[model samples]
Target: MEKEIKKVNDEISVAAFDPEENSFKSFAEKGFKSVINLQTDEEEQNVSPEKEEALAKDNDLEYRHIGVSEDKLSEALVDNFRQELENLPKPIVVHCKSGKRSGALVMMHIGCDKDMSGEEVIKQAEDMGFECDVPELEQFLKKYVNEH
Candidate 1:
């Protein structure tokens, strides 16, 4: 929890740093059961996936890395991410370079899960400190909500 942790709800949080080994233990001590990473291996500032997975195991936290690039976001990807979010044990911590990608996915999941309007979802995310500034992500979310 060295970085700022933005709680989206009681069950979920988003942050920028991939917790280090000690921080993983802190996360478990703080009641986080899972860590979901949205950045790809190639992303700048990302820790190696091997290290992240191992640390989660050492700390008794489930770890999942599902990379989502802005240019490549699709309904199928978001649907898959939503399913994973539903299945993963919580309270969960999701992170990317700056939390934007994680926020986008979480916002989309909330919108789809609660049958909320896209505007409502965006406002909720903004209130939680996750700015949805990526236009591709915004467009995808709007389309996803309309179709689903």
Candidate 2:
């Protein structure tokens, strides 16, 4: 819980650093009703999704794992993420290994939600220190923003 939980719009928030298995209680204490984990299962140090879900349930928080690896990011994944975000309880925390993936999706989701242009979304993300540096990722983000 050392990292700050950054506010992204009204209902969505993100942690500045990755959350360990034991961070669920702290998240619950911080009033996050849902936890969105963006880390892939194959990634090092990630506990099983079921374990994380159980931990979240133990803390009385909703949990969903929408892991999108850096190389595997796609429009469908972003769409799925948006659907999950819309359906989940409010005041959710989105987290990935370094917060980049979480930030990337947040920006895309907000871009559409706020009707921001692609450039505006990217600039907002960069201003928040969460630039989508990867070219492919950036393309998908812009595409989502532009089309959605």
Candidate 3:
């Protein structure tokens, strides 16, 4: 049996694991309201969005598929995900293959969500296995607090 790492809070409920293709069944049972997927087609690791939607519909959970990369999270993409974060209902689950992308996105959001510094957010990402391959993330962090 595969185990999902659970991060519970009033604002979010994240799970890190490869959601079974049938995991939708479990999601329904668990009463999750939303899902944020971080996998990307650029890496050839695309999951079926149609299937995911079907499962979400069956389970009554709102699902959003956003592709987040570990090595390089583009400014535009980060902004897009940031917007999604703002739109998502609380207690959402964000996930990727090994939780790395999920962690990075979560860190990015934290930098904005909690007013954390880039180094602080990077440390958070490092704690999960995401390496910062570019300097843009630091700049993004600086701007996050001032703007969104």
Candidate 4:
């Protein structure tokens, strides 16, 4: 899979494998305050939400589990997730199976919340491999801006 882990930036990072699952124990040790997991347990090979929750709790980080799917990335869920996200502390690690869908959700959140253009959002999402091939996701995003 070419190691689906990278610094999307400095504060926000993405990964298919959790740092708690491997090296980089510093992320956990340094008291990162929150973790928003977009990954569903069944889809990821070795990731367990229970284990993640344990690690986060052990590190005193607040944890939220929002299990989004290719089939159900709807507007309502996005909005609700965004609301919850706004309440979380910084240095939040939002992750999914490959972090691609989480990146897509982040793009959608930016578009829906900050009035970013659909073209701008989709372009960023495409850079992360979160394309419009999925009908549900496309329809939801289209409703966000009335364009494909």
Q: Find the candidate with the highest lDDT and give its number.
A: 2
- Model 4 per-residue lDDT tens digits across residues 1-148: 3455444444455555544454224456544567778876666545477777776776777778888887766667787777766788866667776666677666676676657677777776777665556666655665664431
What digit string (tens of lDDT, one per residue) describes model 2 on residues 17-46?
A: 767777889999988899999988888745
What's the candidate order when arranged by decreasing TM-score? 2, 1, 4, 3
Q: Is candidate 2 or candidate 3 better by TM-score?
A: 2
Q: Which residue segments of model 1 deviate by more than 4 Å?
A: none
Task: Give one digit per residue, the lDDT tens place, for model 3 in 44-144.
Answer: 44356666767777777888888665455666887887777778766677777767567656676777777777667777666655555546544555455
Query: Who is ahead in TM-score, 3 or 4?
Result: 4
Predict model 3's lDDT versus the native: 0.67
Off by over 4 Å in 2: none
Q: lDDT of each model, Cα atoms only?
A: 0.81, 0.87, 0.67, 0.65
Q: Which residue pairs come into collision in candidate 3?
A: none
lDDT of 1 at 118: 82
Model 3: which ten-residue window has the lowest total lDDT? 137-146
RMSD of each: 1.7, 1.4, 3.5, 3.6
Q: What's model 3's lDDT at 140?
A: 57
